[model samples]
Every structure is written in structure tokens, then in C-alpha cells.
Target: MHPLADTYGRRFPYLRLSVIPACNFRCTYCLPHGYRADPNAAGPLSLDEIARLLRGFTRLGMRKLRITGGEPSLRRDLTDILRTAASVPGVERLAMTTNGSLLTKRLDAWADAGLNAINVSVDTLDATAFAALTGHDRLSDILEGVDRAVERGLTVKLNAVLLRGVNDDQLPAWLDYLRTHRVGVRFIELMQTGDNLDYFRRHHVRAELLEQRLRDAGWTALPRAADAGPAREYLHPDYAGRVGIIAPYSKDFCAGCNRLRVTATGDLRLCLFGEFGIPLRALLQRDEQIDDLVRAIGGQIGRKEKGHFLHEGRTGITPHLASTGG
Candidate 1:
């Protein structure tokens, strides 16, 4: 049994590792304008380093892993990284989260490299709106990428960031689109953090409102089947897949939080909205043994804050989502 089991006795084994910190598109909600480019920001965890981390975590009973980034596809050695991760012992599932910009050409390769599933960040269907949100008019590319992922038999999930006035009206359209495509659609509520506060004041769409709208439109919202991430999932009455609502601001799911994040720079974050983390890069550089790393990870997990107190005037402690692993 893993030593890092939480209060509910659930083993905290899953890890979301960021392979790169820099992104090609500067989404308005993610990064602010005049985003200074950090030259040393993106160099990834080397295949050897990642493999070592994977093996070490598995040794401590980790079974699930997800690769994420500003855009994991931007990594030149992404395929190699996936292959290495898939071969790790005790890693039952390996997944990735990407912007879907380069997925059209790389879907087959990613699947062949043993990537188990994929989550694509797709906020709006309108080409103009998408371009405005991402700072790049690559809507066609993203759509094609989604199609290719489905064709390659990958579990495709569309991650939609619901901004109040910007794309809330597009929710129903996205649901209709997903019904025909047979993929999951997740609606994420914007959280106030870093540059997000500037955007959230103008665009925070609460999940309760979205859920009510869907029900009013004659859709049934079902409870989630498992203890997944922060996303509270629901099944539309006639829809094949599911719809997930991640309301970090409106309703926090801190008690059920099961995952942890490892940044590209090698900081292990216990919670997506938490401030505390330990530098894994320094430990790795010092060759501190695996058991020591596991103990450190467990110690960090033990101190996880109950939840993000957004209603209690909490705003700026959490790191940007892009840098913290999607």
C-alpha cells in the first residue's frame, strides 16, 4: 500500500507532469498581455529523468499518470517521452493534455506511441472567437485535430473554459456537436488567479447557472461515476458521452481532490490552487534516493489545504494554470 493515502484512505498516486512550460498560443484567460518569455522556462524533464521519476513513483504504488504542458505537443521528444512512460512498470494508464493545434498530424503517432487518452482545450466553436481567445486563428487546425484523435481511437475529451459573455452561449452548440462526435465535453469555471482576475471580473461563468441552463433546455444532469478530478461530471439524457463542470471558484471539491502536479521546472504541487510546493529539481540534481523523494511527496500531500476559499476573498495565491500543468 502507498504511504501517502489521504484522510479518506485513498492513495494519492496519480501525478500530472508538465513536459513543457512555454506555449505557442497566448490565450487571453491563461496568460496576460506582454507575457514576458522566460528563456529557461521550457526545457523538459529528460527522458532519463522522467523515466527515473516514473519508475520511482510506481515503486511507491503509483498507477496513473498524465502528461501536460503549455502544450505537450510542443516538445520535440514527446513521442519518445510517451513511449518511455508507457513502458514504465505499474503505470496502468498514461494520458496527455494538449491545445490540439498540432494533433491532426501527431494523433496517429501519439496513439502508436502508447498514449492512452487525450484532452484538448477547446473554448469556442466560432472561428473569430477562438482566434481572439487563443491569439491565433487556428480553429481549423484544432477541429481537425479532434477529428484525427477520434479516428485514431483515442479517448477524446473537449475541455471548454466557460467565460460568461464570451462563450457561455456556445455551450449548447458544443453539446450538440459532442453528441454527434461521441466525445466528452468538460466546462471549466474560470478561477481568479494571476492574470485570470482581470479576465474573471468580466467573464466568470458559474457552473450552477450553466447546469440550470442545460436542464432548462431539457437535458438531465447525472452524478459523476467516480472520484475523478475537480470536474463534477454529468450525463445528458440522450447524449452518448458526458459533460463535466469544474467549478473551482463557485464550488470547490477539495475533499475529493486526488491528483497532484509536477511542473516542468520540477516543483511538485499538491493542489492546483494551493501555494505550497517543494522543488523536485533540486532533489533530483542531488540524487536524493527514491524513498526520500516519496517521503517528501507524502509530507507535502499531508499538508494540502482543505480547499480554495474563493468566497472568503481568496484570489492570488495559486500559480497560473499553464505553468502549474493544465
Candidate 2:
């Protein structure tokens, strides 16, 4: 079969799989009130199950798999998960998004397990601000983990959520760190998603403003990075690392939508701004063959919403970003 193309003809060669929906730090933007998963909440798909699913996706032409979570490092089986994902036949890349609290101890193991890339979420350069923002004081460890990953030659990316009144003022401090570092830094735009509208309304900074600031300060847009991922890549002549801006609100952000999401619980969210989902775990549990799974997923993709609808001042999406696998 050909690659999985949605109704709009955008082929999805990527999959964002959330293995665990529970996180330790309650980042103000994502979990303002803090979080505590239900003690009885069902655990995520098993390692074997996840491997099998990846094989099926690879069979359907998926080339990259990004493992995400409330915090992927929190899972004890993460190394195993990475090893399994890397072993998939057609998976050309295996990456992860993590908070880095546990990365210090596991970085070597993960690198050895064949994780091709890693994106660590680091919103501020100040330790106090980080604790205030995420309700945790592990900033040093997070930074150290990034340094270690760099030393080990891992393709590391830093994801910073630039909240206008929050960490926007720390850009210089962040840029200083980047000047000597080889890791790419991506400044992410705050979005109007889930129960965080109030936060979004207060802190959302348009990437347009950031772009203008970068140019004023001497950074030039590099030919859009070769990745074709959401972030638009840029560069500064003086800096050793690349810069990126992910503007979900901007008109061009969703133009080439080539990805789909599966929650830790197996909910197939066709679009980030929509709540409609096909319970993939149910189908998988029923022992439906790969063909059936593909048919069901293809039909669901055909129903992918035209856009995230943020332009209309509505995110219709209600699940917390963490729960939905951000």
C-alpha cells in the first residue's frame, strides 16, 4: 500500500506516540493547577504491543516515530521502548520529547539504545523561574542533561515555550547558552488549547513578533530546515546552533500537515484542535489485523479537520495538552 494520505492528500509519514500521560512537574502553561493521574488509571500499551504497532505503521510507510509523554523519562521501560522502536524495519528515525529530570541517569543508556534524536523542554534559563513555572527545581539537572547529550553526540533539540510575560525577557540568557552549544533551540508559541485558554490569553506571544526581534538582533532565516517538521528554522551568524520558531497560530503552520497523534491510552486524535477520536486500543485488543487497523485509520484520517480552528478564536479541544500528548 502507498503511504497513509489523509483526505487533503497530505501523506502522514510521521507518528507521535505518547507512551505515558502522567508527568511529574506541573508546568504552569500545561498544568496550571498541577496534576495527579488517577491511581487506577490504566497503564500504557506494553513494550511488545508498542513494537508491534510500530511495525504495522512502518509497513504502511511511516518513516519517523517520536515518543512523547507527560515525561517519557518517567517510564522505567523507556530504554526498552527506544530499543524496540529503533528495531522497527522501516523506521528511519526514533526520537523523544522529555522533561529531562531523569535523563541525567539514563542518557547513556538511551543513546546506546539507538535514540536518533531528543527534544528536551526547557522554558527558562533561570533556576527560580523554572521552578516557578514548572513547580520543580531541577533546572540544573535539565541543563546538565542537555550538555551530556551534546557531549555524547546525540541530535538534541531544546523546546522552549516562550510565554510573553514569563520567560520572554530571558531570550538573551538563552541565546548566550546557544552561542557555544551545538544543540538546536526551538521557541514554541503558546496555543489556545484545552483548559489553558486563560493562560494562553495572558501569555501567548506571536512568533511574528519574535521573528521581527530576531532579525533586528541579527538572526537570518535559514532556508527552511530540511526536516519539514512544524518549526520554521533560522540561524544567526554568531551562534553555533540553529534557531527555530513554531508558530501554530500563524497561517502557514498547518499548511503541510503530515502527522497524526495517538494518546498513551490509544486514542487516535486526527487533529490537535479536535476531540473526535477512534479508539485504536479497542481495535487492537480485538485482534483486528493490520489491514483492518489501516482501513480504520485511513477512514479516520479522511475525517481530519481542515484546520485547528484557532483562527476563529476557538480551540474546541478540551483535553489538557499533557493528556492529549503534546
Candidate 3:
């Protein structure tokens, strides 16, 4: 099998596919005004297009496929998408990241469709704080869904964007939840996007502070999996669950890059914060174009830079995380 390796010899065995860019919630850091449709924007990839896309990537040694979105569950054909991706011969892990608002109603159906793992966004456990942060008052219901997901035996992980003076003080509460539930809670450092400069300055807290806290609490660092996302995970003997820190701005954050992203419109993003995307939608229209599609992808993979310029105050073309499935 041909592996997708960059100039720096980073092999990409994982792929994050964005199914849609429209999200329902008005998260403060992402889309505070909610989703505004672009008049000239094309609709998301069709099921057939998605299948062809997956087939193309699998040929290049993609073994893990993570379906992401502004909120992936919003798609009407999400189950079909999941099944199509799972049917890809080389895709060993089929997972998704959702906001969890619809998890309780759709978890069983999704699991039946071959989704073996999931990451749910739960920024805060407090109902009031959650509503304030995400513009949704469904914290309790979402947590119920989290519990249900764990009960269903899916590999469950919770994503909480670490916001200063917001949910930063809630680690104790998260730790308490982790003590009993065998789930993984990840605190993502708030990142600066093309549009959220002011907000990023106000809310972005260094992830190292939390790392020191974890070290003080006796949490031992855990070894990373070959296809894992950029998270420094830790485990504690007293807790059933684990904690992870996704510090994008940290030193050498992109040194171990092993995943590539495809936008909802079928543009290949070599890096989430890259300067541009190479459109692959036309090639995905027919099965006959697989060879050309793979060539285009491999050619671009060689151009990936060593790391993102996020530290230099450049977020590239990414207006927000939703646009590229961060």
C-alpha cells in the first residue's frame, strides 16, 4: 500500500472529513452569530462523492476516518455516510465528532451504522455556563447522551475548549466525572482563528498551566497511539477515565502530524491552518477519475510545510475551526 508521507516523513494514516459547514449552535469562540450560509457555496459532498473520496484516501493507506462537521449529526444522511465510510476496505476505525445535542436520539442508529468511536463537545457541565458559552441550554440532555454513548460501548471522548475565566476553573468537576466514567476528557486550548483575534486574546490560556496541574495531581503521561489526534494524554490510578490536552500552539505541535483534512466541499487541506486548499470535488464525480484524484492528492501531500504559522499570528485561510473541522 502507498503511504501518504510528507517531505518531513510524516505518514498520514488518519483522515478527518467534514460533511457540512453549517452548525446549529452559536459558540462564542467559533460562530457567535450562528451559521450564515454563503450564497455561492456549493452543497456538501453527496453520498456517492463521499464514498469515492474515502476509496481514494484508503488507497493511500488511510486506516482511520473521522467524520466531522459544524456538527455532523445535522446531516440527514449521516448514517449512510458512516456506513459508506465503514465499508471502505482499508478504513479500520470509523469515528465522528459531534456537538452531542442529538446523540441520545441518534447514538444507536449511528452505532448500528458501524461508528465504533465518537467525540462529543461538552465545554462545561454547568447548565448555565454551557448555555452561555455555546448558546444552547441542552447541557443536561447532552450529558445524558454522553452517558448513553458510554453505555452503548462506543469509544467515547469529550472535547472541552479551554476558555480563560470561563470553564478553566472546572477541571475539578471534569475530574470528578472522570473518576467514575471510563471516558476521555480533552481540554482543547483556545486557538486564534482568522476572525476571532480579539476573542482569542481574551480567552486563550496556556495549556501548560493545566499540564502542571495534572503533573501535580500525580497523573502520569500516557503513550500516544499511532493514529491519535494531537493530544498529550495522561492517566491517574485513582480515576477510571483519562485527561488529554490538545494544545495547538504548544512547541513542536505539528511535529507528529499524521492526519489530513478534507472540507465539506471536497477541498483537500494539507493542514488545517494552511494558506489554501486544492479542490478535489471534480475528480470525485466519477469512479474513472480515481487515478487522477490519487495523483492530485499525493502531489499536494509533498508540499505540506513543517508546521503551521499560528505562533506567528497567522491563522492562514481558516476563518474558524468549523470551516476545516478542527
Candidate 4:
């Protein structure tokens, strides 16, 4: 059995699966121009393969699943994948992270297919700035998509990547916008990944500084919500929802990391920044028995590193967050 340790020695229960490596937008910070796609990268996993892996994982005591991708909505059968995953014996909650451009078309269907919640990436509210950041001129589309998601009764959270000269000044405004719209906003610190490492180093804002700025804006850090991530969350006494900061670079939360990631091509990553992953595709292709699959998974978990070392730098890695299923 895989003895995954929690605060009280509890086995890990959450899994983040990246269903595809294809994205609709090329965010400047995520994957700038000139980045070449891998010629030998495997295609997306079949729905059956995804279902089989989830079944094995659920049997191993996983209950929460978050579907991510280059942009998970880019997948044609994403609803089917969500439905199959939800049908697993022990899987209880199914969530997804997307760029939100295509969510308008799939929101209701995804909800019907067992998607519980969604985290939408919206860096700024300005149309011109949005286009500059994402290499797409579709701010109106993204906004409409968010509206559609909320209208469908989907719990929506806005993910804002806070870069210094880029969108730092808009933090309060973003929070105000989400509050007026009754949506949650999360501020993510720029990590040293993709082509934005230099930009991140130059404009990276720390959580402490962010909190202080919020204080200056008359907000106070509140006790974090139970389901919240590493983001130190805050609330304006007058706002409907809350604002949070995810400072992965300034403050690492690897010890409390209860999640594992499965890349679209079927590589199971133990941690977000971990160097290696276990290949589930090969094992599935070999038609490994259920019991054997479980053992292999458990062994991989045993070898899971304590956490990722981002300071070590991406010396030879080439996969950006988008292609890696972030």
C-alpha cells in the first residue's frame, strides 16, 4: 500500500489530471513566441485510458479530482472524460481549470457531466492589456464565458497572475471587479517557468507585499477558507467573496501539498515542479492487471520527492506550464 503522509499520516486524497497538452491561447508569460512544440510528444490519452487510471486511483483512496490542461476545454470529449471520472467508485468531486474562452459553449454540459467547479484565468479587465498578455484579442469572449459559467450555477473563481509592471496596479481593481460580479479572485505569484522567468524575476510580487498593499487598500487578511489552496486569502468586509494570493515562489507550500498531477500524455507527476514522473501510458498499454497497476502506482508514490526545488532553475527542461497541463 502507498503510505502517503499527511499532517496526521493520512494518505493523499487529491489528484490534478491534465487531460490535454493543447491550448487555445499562448499567454506571453506561459509560452512566449519562438518556443517549439515537441515533435515526439505523445498525443492525448484516450477517454478509456483516463477512466481506467481514475478507477485505479479511486480504489487507492483518492476522492478529489481536478481536471486541468493546456486548456482542458480545448478537448472535444472533455465532458465525457469528466463524466467517466465522476463515475469512479470513490471519486467525489470533479473540478477543472481553464482559460475560460471556450467555457461558454461547454459550461452547462460540463456541469451536467459532473464538473463541480471551475477556475478561470483572467489576468486583467482591460481589453488591450488582456490581448497583450494572452496573445489573443478576446476579452469580451472571456468575460461572456465567465458570465455564462456563473449563470449555469457553476462555482467560479478568477485566477489572476500578478506580474509587477504588467498587472500589479490592477490588483485592487480586479478584486473590485470580481466582488461586483460575485466571483472569487486569486492572485498568483509569477513562477519561474516557461519563457517568463526573466520577467518573473523582474516583476515577481511577494505575498507579504501583496497583503500589505491590500491592507493599505483597507482590506485585512482573513482566516483561509477550508477548501482554499496555498494562497493566503483576504476579504474586504464589504465584498461578497474573497481575494487570495498564491505565492509559490516566495512561500512554498509543498509540505501541505495534498495533490498529484497527471500530464495529458499520461505521465503522473508527484509534484508541480518535480523533475520526473511515472509513465501510466506504458503500463496501461501493456494491459497490466488491476492489482499490478495499484502496486506500481503505490511504488511511484513511495518515491515521490519531498517537494520541487524551483530555485534550482529549469536547466534543461522545455515543457512550459501550458504543455505540462497546468
The C-alpha RMSD of each candidate to the native structure, in angstroms, is 2.4, 1.8, 0.7, 2.6
- Alpha carbon lDDT at 195, candidate 3: 96
For candidate 1, lDDT tens digit of each residue in 1-326? 46366655555667899988777878888875524557756466787778777766777677778999878888999999999999998888888989888887888888998997899999998999998988989888888888888878887888988888889888767877867786788888887775566677898878778877767767665654332556766766577777777877654466666677888767787677666667776455434566677677777666666666676656434556787776
User: Which consecutive 10 residues in model 3 have the weakest lDDT in total?
Assistant: 1-10
Q: Model 2 residue 145 lDDT?
A: 93
For each candidate in the order shown, give its overall lDDT on alpha carbons: 0.76, 0.82, 0.94, 0.76
Writing each residue's lDDT as its tens digit, candidate 4 over 155-188 gives 7888888888888888657766756686778888
lDDT of 2 by residue, 1-326 (tens): 45887666678888999999888888988887766787887779888668767766776778888999888887899999999899888888888999888889999999999897899999988999999998999999888999999898888999999899888887788789889999889998888776887888899888778878888888888664322568877788798998888888888577777788887877788777775767777556534566677667767667886678888877655457787667
**Lowest lDDT 10-residue stretch of candidate 2:** 220-229
RMSD of candidate 1 to the truth, in angstroms, is 2.4
Taking all chains together, each candidate's TM-score versus the true structure is: 0.91, 0.94, 0.99, 0.90
The true-structure Cα RMSD of candidate 4 reads 2.6
Cα error, residue 105 of model 2, in Å, equals: 0.3
Clashes of each: 0, 0, 0, 0
Which candidate wins on lDDT? 3
What candidate 3 gets wrong by more than 4 Å, as runs, is none
Candidate 3 global Cα RMSD: 0.7
Q: How close is candidate 1 to the true structure, as a TM-score?
A: 0.91
Q: In model 3, how large is the Cα lDDT of residue 125? A: 86
